[model samples]
Target: MHIVITGANRGIGKTLAGRYRAQGHDVTGTARDGSAEVVLDVTDTGHHADMAAQLGDQPVDLLICNAGVYLDKAERIDGYPAEMWAQTFAANVTGVFLTVQSLLPNLRASQGKIAILSSQMASHTRAPGGSYIYRASKAAALNLGRNLAADLRGDGIAVGIYHPGWVQTDMGGAAAAITVDEAADGLVDRFAALSLDTSGCFETYEGQPHDY
Candidate 1:
């Protein structure tokens, strides 16, 4: 299997890359600084094109859009800045779309699975105070994944949105609920179970259904 993961130099994405590689899968880890096999800044359109060019006709069995930002993680109600919102959406929402679109050909060749790493916070039913920008951007990602699932079903590509548990990573913080390895292991199963019939589902890393 050929797996491509974005924002993979650190955090959950990094762990996923390592685990997949260990499993003997051809894993490509992308980072913004050209420090990875694929240097892709998800927010940059040009980088997406470059990535496609780099891969050429290689088959992509799985595309994980794990690149995201949480700029307003601790911002209070009145503290959310306009620029922060735009930056967050650019990375968390627009970036995911661009990656999927740019890699469409590769995915089509392999009938790949797309995993959008949305968050439990993306759910309207789990609304907690703070992290306004992160929450909204992730919600948009979930919406995008759901619609893409519908549109890509005919192409044999499955798209699923997921809330990787609160993991102990730089983004999740040390006090988070689960370790990076734990989340990655569970998510691997979730990704493996993805198919046309289960596309568009909002699921947790542990296989539980998440409320939209």
Candidate 2:
């Protein structure tokens, strides 16, 4: 199986890449700093184009849209600047869309699946009020993945939006509830279980259905 993962330089993405490689699967990991097999700043369409060109018709069995930002984590209710919202949305929402769009042909070729790593914060049921930008962006990403599943189902592509758990990563922080390996392992199973029948599902890393 050929897997493509964005933001694979660290955190859960890196763990997933390592796990897949250990299982003897072909993995293409992308990072903005060129540390991985492909250099991709997901917010950049030109980078997406370059990535697609580099892959050049390689069938992608799984495309993991894991690149995202949580810039307003420390911001107060009155502190989130407009530029911060723009930057966060650009990375967390638009970036996901562009990656999927650019890789559409590859996904179609392989009849692959898409796994979007949104957050539980994206859920309307879990509104704790802080990190508004991140929450809204993730919600948009969830919506994007759901609609993409509908549109791509005819082409034999399945899309599943997932909350990768409160993981102990830089973004999730050291106090997070789960280890990176735990999140990655659960997510790998969730990704494997995704099908057209469950394409538009919003699920947790542990494979439980999440409220939209």
Candidate 3:
């Protein structure tokens, strides 16, 4: 499994990178800080393309768009900073959209799988909004995954969206139910077990599907 992951310098993405590397798979991770195998600021569509080119002609087997943002204490929809909302969408939604869409040719050649990191907050099932920006961004990402699944099905490429659960990362906070290691490991296991027939499902790291 040659995997390319975003936001791999810390949290769940970092954990996933380490796990894959330990399992002897070729893993390329991207971070804006350039600390990972590749530097990728996913908001910059051109940079995403450049990173793909940097990997040469080899097809990436699995691409994980795991970078995201959380509004923290400044959570509000009515009067939140528009810049923050834009930035959040840049990393959370547009970044994932562009990266996956731009890399479709390579993915098609490999018949690869793409996993977009979404959140339970994306769930319209339980929507009420304190973390307005975070929720909206993730919701948009979920829809992005759905659209990609539909678009790429003919290419034999599988697309999925997943929530990492409330993991104990900086974004998830200390009281979150799982650890980064736990969440990453669970997601990897679930990824390996997914069938093409079930590709578009939005699932948790634990493999239970969530309602869109």
Which scores better on lDDT, 1 or 3? 1
Poorly placed runs, candidate 1 (over 4 Å): none
The lDDT per prediction is 0.94, 0.95, 0.87
Between the candidate structures 1 and 2, which one is better when assessed by lDDT? 2
Candidate 1, TM-score vs. the true structure?
Answer: 0.98
* TM-score-sorted candidate list, best first: 2, 1, 3
Candidate 2 residue-wise lDDT, 89-165, digit = tens: 99999999999999989999999999999999999999978989999999999999999998999999999999999
- CA displacement after TM-score superposition, residue 124 of candidate 2 (Å): 0.7
Summed over model 3, clashes come to 0
State the displacement of the C-alpha of residue 42, model 1, in Å, after optimal TM-score superposition: 0.7
Model 3: colliding residue pairs: none
Global CA lDDT computed for model 1: 0.94
Candidate 3 segments whose C-alpha is farther than 4 A from its true place? 76-78
Candidate 3 C-alpha lDDT tens digits along 1-212: 78999999999999999999999999989999889888789899778878878887778889988987786446544667889889989889999988887777778779999998899999999686588888888999999899888888888888889988999998888999988988988899877875579888899999998989
**Candidate 2's error at 27, in angstroms?**
0.4
